[model samples]
Target: MKIVFYGVITAIALSCNVQAAAIDFSTAWYQVAQKNDALQAKKEEVKYSQALQDAAKSLYLPNVDITGSYTHFDKPISVDTPPVGNFIPSFNVPLTNQNFAHSSLNAVLPVYTGGRITAAQDIRQAQVDEAQSNYNLATRATFTQLVQYYFGVVLAEQVYQVRLDAVDALADHLNHAVKFEQQGQIAKVERLMAQVSLDKAQIEAQKSLRDYEIAKLALTKMLKQQDSVLPTTPLFVNNSVTSVTPYLTKTLTDHPGIAILNAKREQAKGMVDMASAKHLPEVMLYGNYNLYSDDSATGELLPEWMVGVGVRIPIIERSGTSQEVVAAKSSVRQVNLLQMQMQQDLSILVEKTYAEMSQALEEYNSLASSQALSEETVVLRQKAFSQGLSTSLEVADSQLYATSIRVQRLSASYNYVKSLAQLLSVSGDIDHFMDYLQINGIEVK
Candidate 1:
């Protein structure tokens, strides 16, 4: 008994794992979004962020330099002739093959920059924020599109199945009606009705098949793969949008577009600071060690070294202060307007999605009831016709109605799922979906 129980448990566990491995819509959608071509551009944005950080740190390091120079002499002076070599200069010093070598090491350390470094660092940090915001915006847009495409394919498949079932039911009814008419149990008109119903059902089935094929192509395009038979899976839905209001508010507050503008505004302010500081003086501490060698048969002058400090007071920079100030003010104004526009747009989107979700939920529920009732009517009408108490037309009509209701139900469900996704997207909860995908172990590819 223990062995049998263990075997059953193992089988159940494997089956559960297989089911869990099925492609979840939320997971597949996010994976496709993350791997999208747009994300590549966002990744480049992240690179720009790192670049900004590097630029900011650059000013902190001391400048070190090593230099060597060679000079040729038209006429060489004889230092041995007199003191300070003055006698050789008037006594006709002869030109000779002479080479002088000098090498130096220099270092510059900034004692003060009048806030130039501070302004520069602030600008770079703002740049990083801008890049991050742009990346986030692209990511959100891609996620929205992937959700739409993924759900579209799944819903199309369901509609196709519903139409197929309709065709089968109509075929069975038509076959029965023909036998009844031949046996003189039903009128020829009733048999004709059954035939017409079958024809209509088949037509609808063909159309649904075409739609299914198109949906497959769409899904394949999104995933960047070849179209083939799609696997069956239950549609995942977040029915509790009300429960996520707090999340929605949080995301909207920190939306990437607004952040991008804020970053730009900050950069503009930094530029203004930089421009103001440009008129101020900068102090630098510098040191240098020089080595010079004079070679001779008798004796040689040894190497000499020197060190110093310097200061640069900016009395004037041609149009530097005025131009930067103007640019900075203009940039700040532009960013402020951009932020306002984005906020307004987001508000409208949130309202529209909320309305859409409400309508979709109502429609889905209505279609669910209609499908159930239509299905029951079909069963009853078919049984009544077989007993010779109901006309063939009644059975055919009920079957067609049932099939159409099923299709409507599928469409309603699909729309509801999409509306919910759109709501989540506006609120910036897409990462939640991505996390679900990673946890499921389903790789994007």
Candidate 2:
């Protein structure tokens, strides 16, 4: 633990003034979010549950205890004038016992616990399963959020780059317009229109740059660092062959939320059995050995050993036992209802996120084509303007359309990757998602 803490501290020192370092989806999801403080706390929770499971095993083992006592009498204990004294008249019978002490060691082995031990073991196992499920849930949720912030920052950067490109393109157009107007080939109004377009592009570029900064700051927080996030991976998708059907079953079986509900249901069932077990009997086997010391005129037995069996049964209870049994069974019923509800909710989430991903990918493909066409249009129009075959308005309009389509294209690409991440998380398979990235040449290091 100390090593991990110091490692993060050292990384923080290096990152504070570090240059832009490339970070990938797998690195951020596995290294940063997986080691976040909250997720680490859940890891501790799993350990605690394991410890309880170990404790439950001791219920079947024997326990040993040591006890000692001392007693003092001012006068001493005397034997009453007895027949032994009369029979031994020749010998004087004295009675004075004082300063007595005894030390004993006792051990008890449970022979039967009325099914309590079995129930306890079941409950502990369920607890361990629940903790594991919770840890899994934490892992998925952390990765989900990190994916959003990671790609969000990248998307912002992309948008800013596009805006920057537009500003530069518009600046060139403005310069050409000025030269044409000064040469008396174009009117002053055309030059003014070019200036207006460049001004607007510059203003929007500034806003995009600020937005990009904000997104990077958000990613930094998610990474729990003082440095900026530099997403090295590009926003791309080639998961056409990957469909949503294969994952539905795996999601139902492996998703942590459903696992949690199932664990709770089992725990409730254990409680019910434990409550019923309270009405049965318990038995134990015990052994004791003792050492005694006494100063007495009448000697006593000094050391002794004893072994015995014990049993306990609850003879009667008014409504306590029955009421507990009733409540525990009802709790089982409640958990069952919750399990059903959770399964339905999980299915809905899976299907909905899958559809969103498909739609975003489709939108990205369409906008990408539009952006290509718009880029070609801008180039041809600018060439025409240079040759005196087109006006500055035509060139400026083409540039504006190009920028708009590029912005939309970047947005759609971000949504596609973001929704794909969501789908992977909903299906509880971020590792597979990482694999998909690698398969598509989006290296994660």
- Candidate 1 lDDT, tens digit per residue, 96-131? 336556677878998788787988898888888888
lDDT of 2 by residue, 1-445 (tens): 2234334433543453266557877777766755589999999999999999999999999999998877777866655543455564443344545666667888999998888899899999999999999998988888788878888888887787787678778888888888898899888988889988887877787677778778888888778765676887777766553677866777888888888878888888888888898899989999988655455543355447899999999889785988898998898889888878888887888788888777866776777678889999999999998888988888888998999987887777777777777777778778776565667533211
Off by over 4 Å in 2: 1-18, 72-99, 224-227, 295-303, 383-394, 440-445
Backbone clashes under 3 angstroms, per model: 0, 0
Note the Cα lDDT for every prediction shown: 0.70, 0.78
Q: Candidate 2 versus the native: TM-score?
A: 0.86
- The weakest ten consecutive residues by lDDT in model 1 span 436-445
- In the predicted model 2, the residue pairs found to clash are none
